[model samples]
Target: MTAEIKKQKHVGRWVAVGIVGVIVLALLAAIGWYFVRVNPSVQQVETIETAFPEESLRPEAGEGDGQPVNVLLLGTDARGEGDSLLTDLGDRADTILVAHIPPDRESVQIMSIMRDSWVEIPGHGMAKVNSALAYGGVPLMVQVVEGIIDQRIDHVSIIDFAGFEGLTESMGGVTVNNDIAFSYHGYDYPQGEITIQGEEALIYVRARSPFSDGDYQRVHNQRAFLRGLMTQLMTRENLTNPNRMADILATISPHVATSDTFDLGTVASLGSQLAGIGNSNIQTFTMPTLGTGMEGSQSVVHVNWDGVEEIRAAFDEESMTTFEPPAER
Candidate 1:
């Protein structure tokens, strides 16, 4: 063969390989964009602006030396079958939790507030804490929580229980330690490590009738399941796999609504901040409350005034590591 013909053959082969590489790169980019589009749109809460004074706002992470970030995580029940995962203001918040990440970001402290805690809801007189959402939506709920804890709430995220089902299913399921054996709604849950998925996970958090303590046990179960879920999410397999993580986020995103200040960037930053924290380092406690009693015709969990000072001190100091719940009644 002539030298020119040999050179042409070599160059043509190189050109063909380059073309295939470009096509493959383009395909990967398109796949990534599709997953990005799957991210749920953020729903803004306009009234949050008027909910509290500017001075009451907690500084965002990376401000100055950085400060503890307090996020209000709310879980609302399904309005009905086939309801959208993103719950509306009309629905009552069944599970209210304050997830506090300290300045060091070495640990996370989660405090679950009883939904039926009798409290003074801003502009709504005294009512169940959860009623704040019904009166003025997320803003009012934030105000009510701020009033009770005396701490500025920096961000908020609300998730429908249906999202829990999707998230659990996507992750293949989660295993939670059940301290007590109980059966509810035809599902038997033994006392030990229990693996649950989809609808079973929803029922796990919603089951309150089987225990004499009622919602108290239910709250514990929710926290346990949440810790388990977080553990699973942060595992090497899940975190390193972008597609898997995206799938899990996509499943829950549609059913999630956040404060106007919260966005994908905020989510990423917070995740990075808490990445060092592990399940053992994360502590969960229920807000101090007196035993259940009647307030009018409704049963309510009375806020324990004596224990509030301890909680307030820890919150004010951002020292939840030293805080302890009051002894159970």
Candidate 2:
């Protein structure tokens, strides 16, 4: 975050925050709709429970860095949803992702760090990266992810899956391309394009048991959902109706936790900056891993340190636009 006001760029794509960006992008692209008046009682953004990692542990950069900036986004499985999670010590972040916006602001790159990927926690020994949330709330989650990328996280936010229920309902539904046919939560998702809304929408993104590849496919589904959501928001139906768009965005506020510095004004500006980034400009991939194995009595994903170095180099050079993710394991 910037030293002056800690204004980290809003992630152009995130399950929770990502959807919000599309909302902003759609609004910004529409006439007289970019300026959203957030109801104080229903603001979708909130300050995290814990402060960021100690300054010493964070990389020195700010809003002025002109360097690529990173935002950490956590998606939970429902335990201690939203701000309540600040005090819910047992809650673990189920989805861990880093959204990188290059200095040019011409494109966005989303890197998903598997929650099960074994990594070093600040004060704890190696363990599932998600465990960092359980150990020290948002602060530790930010610390662990930063350590992996070797960069300071300018801002952090989280959202619970439950929030998507209302969020999806507000949009009528979102459509995504399904690669595998699967029945989940009593709903049959065919191997083709389908529209999902309400409870089924949540079921679609959270269904991993239906895939042999498990979370691997689930993360892919998450990105697909975001892709569809962006299309829905950009539809003339939503962009033309300011009231409808405002209410749809509000449905997610109670379920998201972001830094207090993440205000609507800043969000609008970033939205304006990223207004031109279409789905093609927003790329998604997972951190490289050798494979999964027993890291004791527990199964864990092993990080590909060599691949990580390549990723670090890509970030350093602001060449992520041309970077290719490692082949899936």
What is the overall TM-score of model 1 with all chains considered together? 0.79
Clashing pairs in 2: 1-154, 14-18, 44-253
- Give lDDT tens digits, candidate 2, residues 131-157: 887788778888888888888787677
Model 2, C-alpha of 90: deviation from truth (Å): 3.3
RMSD of each: 6.8, 12.3
| lDDT digits (tens) for residues 150-238 of candidate 1 | 66788887777777788899988999988989988888899999999988888999889999999898888988888888777766566
Give the poorly placed runs of model 2, Cα more than 4 Å off.
Answer: 1-36, 41-44, 62-65, 78-83, 89-91, 231-242
C-alpha lDDT (0 to 100) for residue 192 of candidate 1: 98
Where does the lowest 10-residue lDDT sum fall in candidate 1?
A: 40-49
Error (Å) of candidate 2 at residue 114 is 1.2
Root-mean-square deviation of Cα positions for candidate 1 versus the true structure, in angstroms? 6.8
Off by over 4 Å in 1: 1-63, 78-88, 318-326
Give candidate 2's root-mean-square deviation (CA, Å).
12.3
